[model samples]
Target chain A: MSTLFSGQLLFAALVVGSIYVLIALGLNLVFGTMRLLDAAHGDIVMLGAYTSFWLFTLSGMSPLLSMLVAGALSAGFGAAIYYGLFRRLLANTQLSQRLEGNSLLLFFGISIILQNVAALCFDTTPRAYTYLDGIIRFGNVAMTGNRIAVLIIAAVLCAAAFLFLRFHIYGLAIKALIQHRQAAAVVGVNIERIQLLSFAIGFGLAGLAGSLLSMTEQITPFMGFPFTVAGFVTVILGGLGNLTRGMAAGMFLGFVEIYGVALTSPSLHSVLIYGVFIVVLFLQSQGLLGRRPS
Target chain B: MQPVPIRTSLIFVAVIGAASFLPQFGSEYVVAVALSFAMWVALAQSWTVLCGMTGYGSFGHAAFYGMGAYVQVLTWGTLSPWLSVPLAGLVSCLFALAAGYPALKVRGPYFVMLTFGLAEFLKFSIIGIEATLGQFSRLIIGAPSPNALYLAMLGLAAAATLITYVVSNSRFGYGLRAIREEEQAAETIGIPVARYKLTAFGLSAFIPGMVGAVMAMRLSYFEPSQAFDALISFNIVVMAMIGGSDDARGPLLGALFLIGLSELLWARAPQVYMIVLGALLVFFVLFAPQGLAKQLFGGARRRAT
Candidate 1:
């Protein structure tokens, strides 16, 4: 493992991690502030893929337009979930501790629905957009132009979201809410509005990631569940609700995953990733960069 | 179980007796249907014991099921079919032992995510193993006769039901229920929260493992996607949830209902089945999160009588 930490692997990790970052930050925002786990997040990414694929398939539109369209659509879906499912749960739930538990069921249901519907519409076979077929080389290493595009898009979006949380008026409120919801409320933050905003932003980012994913990977209705699970792992690695840390952790995980895939037999790739996840969990349950104990 | 009224006991006996003897009277199709229903009952019951009762929600229980199937397929060439169940159960129990401590250290969504991740990890590891061995070719095994398989599944289901019945009525069940209601308070009041949770999780994984192995034998093959699918966990979770998890009978009823519904959809409109399942799940989560049993039968509150 130590010997594998060369620049190439590190660079590969960065690219892979950036791909992960496209969706994880959104999950982090919702998980961190609202404590809602939105397990359907990966499905949103899958939808983004479809959005791009369909845009190309039907209208011959550019992937960039598809990205924006996907982002908007997913944000709408996220808002719908918040208003239709989450808002009801939040209002009905008496105990703060049990909210996420109850909400998880809703998200699970949503994920199922999303998968089945997408399957019905698109079928289960993987769908990939016919684009970004070029590669860029540096030194002795070569990477796909699609991978670079995904990396740049993911980083830029992550930075934009991080900045929003840092400097935007609503961003400060969200930050305050994540740090201390009760205090944030006392300080006159509109908690519900901000929560909805965060939720929408998270979904929007997921959608964006999905569009970017069209250029890099296969898409399927069922692809979301695994990514959602991995996203959760990323969230835990960076500490729950710690958005920026999630970025770093996402990269770290990408490195681990890429290197794990590289070092082990093809089948053992997932094993190595999971093995690392469990080990890290046992060593520091709080995550490498998380502030609060999950 | 409390000393039941003779009528209720008689009803129970009659129902199970009819089910156990179902293969004798029906075609192989009936046997197959019964087998699937029974498997769901067993899997859902095993899952509900820890997740439903404890409220920890083991979202990835299918991992145990998949692992059990994997273990069975790997070792079944030498071992007897009956023996594989216990072996798989033991292996899955051990995995729960290893994962539970680290996983249960967190609560709420984190716990759910950890369980989900563990299952995903198992799924990937299986895929990795398959890739390494280049064993994409299907396993060719002497599958049990449909009748024998049906009977075996019925037995497993009965065992699962019995386990849930006993556990739900026992002191251990009470402690688990306490944990579900409020863990920190339960710990403060001396519930041995961690120990109880681990025990619950281990117990939950065992029957599913057994059921998974049985499924492998029944299916006569073990593919990574089909065997270790995370969707199985989702189905079991949905079943446990929709039927309600507050009572021993919840999972049984839920599994029967969903499996029956699935069979119907599978027969008439296989494509629409998942769409319907998704719709039902959303409906249940939003409108009936207490599950149908809780809403219809007045579950735990009514159980006291």
Candidate 2:
């Protein structure tokens, strides 16, 4: 009985944590590499969920297939954003001057646009994949098959992303740009191309997370707002400019949220997550995994 | 020396005079919307102080505003909005002082992100506390007369404008401008960079906090979600950017224009309002980056040159 109970609790935490990790990883990649505070990251997650839902409902496609389609569509959208907005802004500007003033205004505007467009296209009704059903049980513990699948996918993606960043040429180029953009450009790195690829990959991950979330939970157009808060908190707790730290923080946050819900009201879960972030921020001004200020 | 533009003064006076009498002419709905606009203007001006002049873009003014509303609602209810509202502002200033101490150490996007995190933290805390306390949907305590609340808000708005005006001309303002221009240079020149930033942040929090209290009274309700809505923060930032960050009149004009536009758009096509707002922001950033205020006044500065 004890073993089963522990397993159930651990599985629950892992499942919740995986979703947060997926979202945080995307945000961390974007912020870490590009130094762009894309507030639209959460919206991308939201759009992905909606797209997947529509695909499943309208075309009767398998949820897994829809997830891939949604991710691809979101990646394309992210690339367009890079080309249309960020690239134009970065062109003819120095690196230090690139991140200030109007960039914030531009992204924020894009967020608003995406949010309203989602609302218009999909009415403000919460959606879910109803076909994916049947709870799987191991002794006293129980969870949906979809939840189990989501966990596996999340684990694979996390490992894949880590390996790619550590070993892949494109990932190395991204890291180079992040460390020093001008120097990277000086060394013959195509900074703009890397930026587009980085954004697409980051946003694509968010989309994939969104699709997974919709499998187990309901989706809403405005859900992006809460997720934005969550993603930022997770990334902050993990440390800026560190993907590994972000993943760890996401898992920690997931467990915290689950335990908080179990111990207290579910409503307080978000509050507890945020409270922990605040405490961590106070303790180390640079964040949990960030280096000391220069 | 030529008198400071009678045409501008006259226009201001006429606008204020007309606004003061609007409650009498309009229906309850119109009055409510106008009052909301007034609240937005106050909030935008508050944001402009830190973001526009001081070069610290706060992505969390709504937190301070929500704090002000919460403090007032928890303590005084809506019985005496005139007194309670300013108290809310005071509370917000104190909170800003405390939060800004550690946050202001970072610069650029980091500072903005920090503020955003703090705001989200505050919002979540409010919701969590409210849920357990069973006060999640509590309405504002007292049902004060709307007329009185309206007048009080107007007074608060005027006071906020005056404060901004004073800050724009004062030595502190000069220091803030110095810090905004170049923090390292300001530090080299013996200006207290951190202290000035904290003071500006506190003052920025003060106006929105007060306006929020007034809003609580006018609406006579308080919910965590509504109080700490991120949309409020977005709208204030947009309005401030659109109007002009540097001048006192900029935020006011921006707030009025955006609020008016929101009303018209919402009435015509509620779903598309966000899209229009988004497009407008992009347009302004790419084209009129200096804002409408600068565009109107900038030409004069050039002509004089």
Candidate 3:
């Protein structure tokens, strides 16, 4: 039991939690802004991983560099999806419930398209690459250099995203839109532009997370769904659209999952995570940090 | 919800009666195709009972189906499938009854996520249980013949459609539609919102459970992962959406259309079938939000809002 709370487990929890936060950040952005749940968000993550994979396999470019490339490419894709698909859906405000319902189905369709396309283009077999595969030890706990890199880079990116959303003018505009879409539009916040920007950024973060994930794990066309589930769980836990709270919840989920698995069995990790998700949902449908309706 | 016309009801009976003869005269391939058609129709129509009626949009019918499959597999040999298949439906109904309280608490996207999460939770829990038991997969020996299974599935399909048809016309179904149109308003008007939703949820889960059991028996194999495949849930939603979930006839049209399309494409290139299906979902939502049955057969034009 003592070993369950060891520094090794704690470090592992943080590393895994960082990935959850990375993916959830994008989900939070899109859901917060558009009130649309992008079910294909994880597919974007898979695309980014594949992009980084091919970049490395073809040109030997470092994943660190390709991570940015993946982000840019995913952002472009996100913008295209918003423009071509979701724009009209968002135009009408009267069908708010229908909007969420339509978008959910729409994204479900997009996810199917993305998964099949990837499978056809790149066969269903798993792919992997070796980068920074060295050992790093801090006293009694030893970690892979790639994992440590994932930690540092994930932390830096998360902090940068947080600061941008907190302090930037565009960030404020996005927040305003999230808080009150009509009011924000009336106050001169360009609804279309902010929606597109946040959509792109949300997708970009997913791509970035995918690239980082490629450093530590095998990549497959089907890998994105689990991450998508994790991202959704985190966003739900923090209350839908609550970014900072989502991030914290992601980390909290990580600890629970890792420690829970450590105490039980590795195969039960999903059970633990989803058990927590269902419980949180039933107990606090408003989300862990969300205020109760008076 | 309009009343079903006698002529349409007669036509449905004639079509199903004709279909029941396929196993005796149709080739093996034809029987297989018919079986798949019946399975989807059963699954999709049941889904329409809850999700389409209430606008809850559950992404977890796979859980019910999977639960049914698991139950069938566990009870194989010990119990006759005659008893087991309906037992599967009973178990799934009870599961729905248990899960409905928390599940129905949230609306729209939250409902989608919670249902999805619940399915995943069940899937992983089953996987874990299988691992602990050191059984990665289970196989059914001496499973029923395809003809028997096909007949069973066809009955389930007819039953599901009948239930949907009945619900659409009944006061119970009106309550469901009322909830869908405006839950708060419906409750204000003295509709038993909670009870209606729970009953609809449970009712919807029952047929899919039987479908899953029959499908597992047909395959003669059961693995937790395959049984609980999320794609089953996705395909159910897509079929419901494409066929239009508002009426019994919509799911029938949808099941046939998609099954026909899949038969043509999946034989040559499965990837193309998937891509087309996804594109079809987007196209239908954007252009034909009312679905094929509604457009073809003519029904209440979708309330624009």
Span of 10 residues, lowest total lDDT, candidate 3 chain A: A285-294
Q: Per-residue alpha-carbon lDDT of model 3 for B10-74, expressed as tens digits?
A: 99899999999998899999999999999999999999899878888888899999999999999
Instruction: Give the winner by DockQ.
Output: 3
Instruction: Quote the lDDT for A162 in model 3.
Output: 84
Q: Which ten residues in a row have the lowest lDDT in candidate 3 chain B?
A: B296-305
lDDT of 1 at B165: 77
Which stretches of model 3 miss by more than 4 angstroms?
A: A93-97, A286-294, B1-4, B301-305
* Model 2 TM-score, 2 decimals: 0.89
Number of clashes recorded per candidate: 4, 0, 0
**C-alpha lDDT of residue B247 in model 2:** 53
Cα error, residue B245 of model 3, in Å, equals: 3.8
| CAPRI accuracy category, model 2 | acceptable
- Candidate of highest TM-score: 3
lDDT of each: 0.79, 0.78, 0.88
Candidate 2 lDDT, B1-305, residue by residue in tens: 22346786687677777888977877878777777777777777777667777787887888988998897788763346567777898999999999899888867765776677689789888887887787767676556778767767776676677677678667787778777778899999999998889989999999888888878777778888898887788787778767865658788889888878888897788769879889888887666666788777774111000
Models ranked on DockQ? 3, 2, 1
Candidate 1: which pairs clash? A26-A202, A32-A241, A267-B128, A268-B128
Measured against the native two-chain assembly using Cα atoms, what DockQ does each of the candidate structures obtain, in the order listed?
Answer: 0.44, 0.46, 0.63
Tens-digit lDDT string for candidate 2 (A19-53):
88988888777776667667777888899888878
Name model 2 segments beyond 4 Å from true.
A1-5, A92-104, A280-288, A292-294, B1-34, B75-80, B140-144, B299-305
